[model samples]
Target: MKGQHVTITSEWTPREGERYVLGEGPRFVDGQPLIVDILSGRLIDSDSGRTLIQIDEPLGAVAPLTGRNGWIAAAGTGIALIDPDGVEWLAKPEVSADTPMRMNDGVADPMGRFWAGSMAYDNRPGAGSLYRVGVDRTVDRVLNDLTVPNGPAFSNDGSVMYLADSARGVIFRFDVDTTLGDLGPAVEWVRVEGGSPDGMCVDENDHLWSAVWGGSRIDRYAPDGTRTASVPVPVTQPTAVLITPDKRILVTSASFGFDQPQVDDGAVFVAETTVAAAPAARYGPSN
Candidate 1:
């Protein structure tokens, strides 16, 4: 079946006393989506808006969470192990930071390591960082001093790691040392004009798909970063995206960033395509 984009959730639905501020990290597990509301640190079940789990911190601002066993690797802080009953226990990040939370978009690599990005809380450009956490609890800094470092997704072969710096409006490519859990010097992979790039994913064909926050669209690019096509959306702020295990395109959007009337304007959208999708990667531990 080809990939398709459609809206499955209502626009700006309220959940756990919070409306969708910034939506990122949409992952399909067990036939349902696990999503994070960035401003509130709430992990929600897409089908019901039930607060499945809560991050025990102030403004946790989580995005692109990957689940494995009982753990969730939350963007901004570190890995959060969610017990079977929906309680979260956080594992401290290996990289030290003055800010309370700095992580952004992340995903589990094909080799089972969690790759996430961090940026200065005050939105300082070029002060963000990236890290990799292995299943055995080993954490290593792979990149540093990024301005709004966000999405980190790997190619189908696991040879290339695509990292995006939102403030720079560009996505970069790095040579991945999978066995070492390391990333090499980044080469400019793709650039977008007038739009900030947020979360990203790799399709079955190894194409890079990125969500543009202000651009109201998702873009597909070839491995070398050539623009393939753009998919328009109803909401202006698209925070994260994923291609489901069955190849359905799921998008999480935001209503909080613009205005009050706009706060509930966001919606979780889906689209269908004939193309298939790669299986989602995994993270380790529950807490």
Candidate 2:
């Protein structure tokens, strides 16, 4: 790893009996960094460690990619609009009743399309898939037979997308169409040996920062997937990574169901870095 020494420290810590319970899907909207407590199904304001809204459903991913009226979330088996009024599904998922697929980590492209993935509840192999919801509200299955799908991020120009299949321990890249949300053939990007890649965020310079679940560290990768830097955390599972507006990288950790938890298991951390974040993409009616 070649870079300046970045300072990583805790940003939010739970109370004695509190647990974050799988923190994931972090995004900055209008400068407010919103994070999801996946298990608890709460959208949190990362700045104050407060719950902004509660949706007692399975929250796979939440990002204001549409950049319109309300944020979009993969709630239950489908994606929905969660605003002050209420929640409404834009397009219902076509999952079979017998399948145990649940939505997981996701992101929006520069052209304003939301992409999310799913995985089986029991980590069943080949029971998950990746879906791309276009700005015009059309849902298309981009990839299938995935396991533990996560980290669907893109470069600023939308010419490249980085996706991770956690169960396979690999992150793959695809050439992308920024406007139509088309994915090209997949190619190997990187492989995390010590842990699985969870959520990721791309910086303004096009470098990818990946959170390694169960590895207690976040590694920075160049556009070519070469590791350039890393920041270690105190907990075992760092689930997601986000770059704030001010260039501070914020990390989400988990301690949800552990019998014995580490002190920082449920705490969120921030790293002081010199890289700026790529501007968040908006999802709306493609005009």
Candidate 3:
């Protein structure tokens, strides 16, 4: 069957003087889309269209989080636990680097572990790596020598993991070991030149949906990495994507580094797709 793609337009901007300069992570929380304003360090409620919660200013830019205690977020230096009421506190890992790291794309695994990556500001190769943050706040590096690691989505059955190296324009797949929480024998799942891969999610049928940053569109790929469909956007820097419970797809864009026509262009759009999105996995409780 052929996949369907649609575009939803934005209705509101974030709080005054607020914009998602990086704008990547978007995750479903309690049937509602909860996203992070990467620049302002705010957690936004897609339904109310409000900055529902604000993390402490010291944490740096935050990423959309899904955790057992109702919320989990990434900071410029670490991760944090958030509650339904938007109360949050740092979930500092016992083992982490001091070489100026910030969490990027991440997802909660079937084992309830949060697997996230970090990258340098300039998207330099070997400047960042992937890490696993357990429910106990323990940190372990899974892979290294990565340049702008993003996406970090798992298959429907949790048997495989899909990640992207944006600068290289390649999506990688790895055998997932849930018990040991390890990624093994990684291979290039797909290599799309000319465009960079940003955020992604898996559909109910297990197909991978990736947002192409410079391409201004979202590309759907079969489990084996075949192009299934493409959904274009009006924005130049399309960054992240999320499929709602009702099977609607929402996209967030960035006006960052754009001129007047583009600055007036930042928007959050939504559209319905033929493929149903997989249910979101809640992060396991703090141990």
lDDT values, one for every candidate: 0.69, 0.78, 0.69
Model 1 root mean square deviation, Cα atoms: 4.6
Best by lDDT: 2
Which portions of model 3 show Cα errors greater than 4 Å? Answer: 1-19, 56-70, 84-99, 261-264, 285-287
lDDT of 3 by residue, 1-287 (tens): 23544333343233234345655577776677766666566767765668866765322223334433455665665566666666444444312654555667777876677777777666667877887777566777778888888868888777889999988889999988877777788899899765788888887877888888888788888887888777777677777777766777877777667656454244666665544675567666434
lDDT by residue (tens digit), candidate 2, 1-287: 24633334434333333358888888887787777888777888777778877886778777674435677777667777788788978765635735666778877777778888878888888888888887777778889878898889898888999999989989999999765677899998898989999889988778888899888888888887778887776688989888876877778888876899877787777656666785566666656
- For candidate 2, report its TM-score: 0.91
Better of 2 and 3 by lDDT: 2
Writing each residue's lDDT as its tens digit, candidate 1 over 7-119 gives: 22323222333347677777766676677777676677776888766665422323223453454555446655555666454555623766645567777777767777776
Give the residue spans of candidate 1 off by over 4 A: 1-19, 58-68, 85-96, 285-287
lDDT of candidate 2?
Answer: 0.78
Return the TM-score for each candidate structure.
0.83, 0.91, 0.84
